[model samples]
Target chain A: MKTTNKIITNINQVSVDQVGIGDRVSRITARSVKNEAKIQGLKMALNMIDLTTLEGADTVNKVKQLCYKGMHLHDAYPDLPTVAAICVYPNFVGLAKEQLKGSGINVASVATAFPSGNSSLEVKITDTKMALDAGADEVDMVISRGKFHQGEYNYVFDEIAKIKETCGKNVRLKTILETGELGSLDNVRKASDIAMYAGSDFIKTSTGKISPAATLPVTLVMLEAIKDYYYETGIQIGMKPAGGISNSKLALHYLMLVKETLGDKWLTNQWFRFGASSLANDILMQLEKQRTGNYQSKDYFSKD
Target chain B: MYIGGKFPRTESGRYFTLKNAKGEEIANMCKGSRKDFRNAVVEARKAFEPWSNKTAYNRSQILYRIAEMLEGRKAQFIDELMQMGSTKKQADEEVFTSIDRLIYYAGWADKYQQISSSVNPVSGAFFNFTVLEPTGVVTAIAPEENGLIGLVSVIAPIIVSGNSCIVLASESKALCSVSFAEVINSSDVPGGVINILTGNAEELIPHFSTHMDVNSMLYCGDDKKSIQLIKENSAINLKRIVIKKDIDWMKDEAESPYFITKFTEVKTTWHPIEKIGASGSGY
Candidate 1:
């Protein structure tokens, strides 16, 4: 979709009802999913994960291990689905790409000065180019929070548009708003609108480096933006709530929110993704517990 | 009731009639299910770190506070015991003994490590010492006969060493268990440190044994089938199993530092020693 002057002008008028969103989220969380439906939700949440290892201490061995874990979540449990992607820093994109080959799992690499978009446009472009050249299937770029906070909405829009241009049509580009740094639900909605209009295939919640990475209310605001965007344009943008969602029950709650907000079309991994690392094992543990009539320990699952 | 520091009904919403020895209904107790046991284990695991990291002196203070709270509510416990068909003298003795047992374990809380841990001599130039650490979450079945005393006897020793526990109260004699839980709640004891559940041992034993998050299993009865089931399921995670079969809770032998040692693990650390001189004068 084209970024028109009309869209930029409409961004300011988009305000969120904080109390209403909170009430809606509470109602959604109160709905329980049990038994067979719970198992199915657990599996769906597992498949939606982008098993991530984005750390300064991350190494080739760690990335490779994470990729392996993404493919084979738990071998003992039959018919377990693999994770959708393996997320890592730009440097390990090629290694993750190689490790995930033929397994049908995508390799997602964080780019554009990820976690903190403090770099220049030239450096951000190089960062995206580096991951793309390494054959990263998806590029997760961070929005310039400094510029956005300064009310430079045009700069943020132009930056995402430029990165989307660099990615072209084949490669999907996910825009990380780093919602923790965005300050409020209003800013989150504004940023979500900017990213979608500027050609972000998916709008993500956080970089996972911030304290309050992904919260229910912030995600709900972003989902409402996605819904509004889908209505405006025929195109559909994915929603990804990354970081701090480490348990199966919370993950299931996220799935419930997504379903209630955006409907069934966005339930698949193609449209929804969890930018998390430890969340995979928790979901695996829940699945194993269901398979065997016993609660599982973290010792049994692989730590990636 | 009293799972995770708060009094909550069983998630299963099922209750069983508690009858007196004369076959008269006394109360309807929660028939705690596996899911309740699971939730209690989750709470116990959450409480383990903070509870175990508390100073030994603080743990002792908490245990002593529990004893004090029980002493304050002694008449209520005696009344519950009588309602459960105990003689007035027997009820009095049981409540007093339960209070005393808590005090006994309270005194041993900070001192057990001194008697149990040791510095060992090794061939290598290393200072090797073995210290006792509280095993994580423990699941215990309180003895069936002495409701208050058995519950106190099993819980005091296990928790004195900083371990958190989820205890299934005696099925037939459970009224005192709930009353004791009220005393514990009023005590300075942290929630989840001692979660008491009223349920059948036969129904909850398998879950108590199989829960992987539980570090140890303590059984207070002599049922061969239940003991064998605990033994077999404990192998799944190699959880430490302590079976107190054929033991009389009223005897002094029931309250021992050795009981505290059963729920603790020995962690030996080897620190390299630097030789001072050829004669190793620093040693």
Candidate 2:
């Protein structure tokens, strides 16, 4: 039922109007979400965070601190839900799992040479297995941008499918397009369709390593791709805008985009996540401000 | 200029002309809007941590660097001060005193901690001592009198103690502040360490007091209504309000290390000592 030829045929039919997308995104962002809806959106945004720290200098203590922070985000605000997951490097997956044990917080490990998919297929499989062996609930892998740029769409599709297969049915596979390197929105749409058809559980925007990681326009194109894929196969996929999304206002705009394009079913953490480290604290600060009717200082909050 | 690191024009794209005493237009300066202040505060907050965490010696060296830069541009400062209705003698004195005030505070930067902190005598088995810490971001309104010296006097103490500040220059005499910002820019002072804005104080003071991110405010002018408004609005975050009025900045008493203490917090620590049981050493 699934073939590289079919994937190419479907993607070739997909064309995105860049000018129209820009106009629509601007209009969408201009719609001000206020008061009650804002509070609700803030809480929902807080609950859907991946609370990530994927720096090269990550340590066991840092992962442990992040794992704890994911569970107890701003203890000052009672009844707040812990973040959906803790995203870390593949090496710290076991440490995060050990720290976040029984907390219902999923541990997501990045693989496939992470942020760059220039390694051999054999290495990618082993990289994914290392995470799985360390109890990672989700595996975020990158597609080979060099191959994708070379017009080898089949190679990219097969690579995602192989990683998805290795992830088994239990672990979700999030394919990082690293869209900043992909150049135009047309390439983004094409990459999104290929990643989806190749069996990605989630299609991520960036590895948080590149500039212009996640913009509303880019996310809109990917969401439209997910919408078209859903109509064709009746399958649902998650969307994550990682990196540089460090405030509540932008996160709320992304939520509004999701609800409008993909409807309410995709609003929960199961379908949406923010791949950010500092975003959690900013969200917490906003929530506290809402409760106390005052602005918050960064000093009161704990660092992850 | 001095948004983040590089010198930039105000984002509002508005500029006001600074006129000489003879009513001739001297120069066009950035008419900083609320947006510029907001941007500067963001940079100040960003620079606060590293600027605060630096060794007191490093801050001293930077403050001294500002004085060195100001001394080299002494002629330029004197000319700007004279253009704003100051006599050549007053302009010369203001520039000289401003440079001296900077050196005075630079001397206090590394030594203020030892002078103000104290070890407390506790009755129990505990070692207790109180140390001073910089109060994050401070916002000040430079006095209307003595533009160069007043601006330096208000700013030096706050930043010498390692608190980053956004200052509102004198409403009428703003050219010197912009020139001073250039001096600060050339000096090794980090961007956002000192942000100077030229604007109406009444329009900007409310924001200076009520901005949720600003930690402390230094009001150098004695406008009763403005002070009242600042006092009332600053209650939202319980911001520290330091109202300085009627004191001539050129006075020798104004150069005390105590001015540095105004923008600092005394943090007392209790370290547990080895506990002695009821059984004595003889027993």
Candidate 3:
């Protein structure tokens, strides 16, 4: 039976006077703490994308399997595990789109120059169009690192805006502000503002191409930008810290910054997502460890 | 949730663009302000009379209703939390803590008086006694972190004591706080018993602290400026100020007892036991 006030009265009668106030406090604290600990196990979930670091045709099947793995495992764990989206080049968008058909998880394609933003605007737009036409729900577009570094921020902004305008509300635009190239927190903040002003749907930390692309500070800066912008405009932008988010504890910390910085309204797939090749299984392993207090199968995860 | 008949969060969510780890757009949060905070206080003050005057048994039921709403919407709370960028685990904790705070407070409405006070020995002949009472309108500046629980911890304590509070909530985490207010509405807190403001605290604190009519102010924030403002505004009318130190709120401390001390007043009435009879018997 659900406990009633009568039950509470009975509970109150339980020789609490014999229990020191400290002990009662500790006892109550433990229950909440245990709940909090269990919650930790569930929250650090990630969408793992094992970038084979491959090119073109070789990427399709691997992408398909990763999507399949995500879908199937998600069927088991439901909300427990995030099906890391299929991260791939523009050409394989069709394959991933077809293979992962009907799977609610994202088919995120790398566009706007992919790993490098060295391409012409025409080529970048075409790549993004192809990916969108291929059923990519999210477009992870790399911003022009050279142009941004050279401080041609407006150009980068225009390009991202064009991409966003082209994606036209159907596809979410994740503008990658390669932090390795952005140089500092201020730049990260500036780039984040530019991307939002330019109409980018989400501001991602890296294209996972550059070294030191996704650091805690960079992500923190980006999240702060999203938060500040939303506070200013009544619009909430998503935050994704791709690459190097390999540890569950780190992921949890990221969640902390996001939670505390943004508030609970932004805590969802729509507001928060992580992009990494290795974070999912690690988080899964940790969650399993938390559940049973023993290590479980890491092999179950599709090698990210 | 509901404040002054309308649901509101503490922050005036000015910043838009909810980004994901990959940087995506999520949803919109309000840009709350100090005016809103003060307005909430106004509502709480208005709501205080009937609510405070309600028998303790009724207050307990209303608080219990809040606990029920919190429990019922737990999942939505979790989902909203995720979008706010909390991991599933962290989201779960936020939800659990929120619900627990309500349930914890619900238990205190009827029992706090039993905990913090005892009969005072009187030198006079009449029945002299003391009891705690509500401090009317109050203002609270919640902590920057632990969005849901922290907000709950402040608002619940203030209202449980029958004082309505205008609170400034964590701006970033206003979603749950917003939604939690709906829970309060459903739970039966009279309109204005708790009002929340969400935005730059600097902008909002001065108004609430210095408001001439405010009866008390709670300083729950870490910034020194908030303290200075609390001091400055409180001086205008000498509002009873409570500067809550940052302690491990994770532990219960059974602090319901403290609320009794905060809101109650001692009453002593004197009556002589010996004299009258003998005067008539002087014959």
lDDT of each: 0.91, 0.89, 0.68
* RMSD values, in order shown: 2.8, 5.7, 29.9
Q: What tens digits encode model 3's per-residue C-alpha lDDT throughout A1-304? A: 1322332233223231223433433443333223456455345345333222235445555767766666665343446654656667777778877876776666778887778889999988998889888877788888887887776766777788789988988788888888888666667777777788778888888877679967766676677678777887888798888888887666666666677678777666677777776676666655654554332334345564
Error of 3 at B8 (Å): 51
Question: Could you estimate the TM-score for every candidate?
Answer: 0.91, 0.77, 0.44
- Model 2: pairs clashing at backbone N, Cα or C within 3 Å: none
Candidates' chain B TM-scores in the order shown: 0.96, 0.94, 0.85
Model 2 per-residue lDDT tens digits across residues A24-80: 899888887777888899999989999899887888898888888999898889999
Assess the local accuracy of residue A163 in candidate 2 as a C-alpha lDDT between 0 and 100.
96
Q: lDDT per residue, candidate 1, A189-208, as tens digits?
A: 99999999999999999999
TM-score of chain B of 2: 0.94
A-chain TM-score of every model: 0.98, 0.98, 0.81
Model-by-model DockQ, in order? 0.71, 0.27, 0.01
Candidate 1 clashing pairs? none
Candidates ranked, most accurate by lDDT first = 1, 2, 3
Give the alpha carbon lDDT tens digit for every residue of B1-283 in model 2.
4566656788779888888999999888888887788778889999898899899999999989999999999999999899999999989999999999999999988888887898899888777999999998999998887678988998899999889999988878888887888889998888888988887889888788877889999998889999999999889888899998989788886678888898999899998767645755321
Q: What TM-score does model 2 achieve against the real structure? A: 0.77
* Stronger candidate by TM-score (1 vs 3): 1
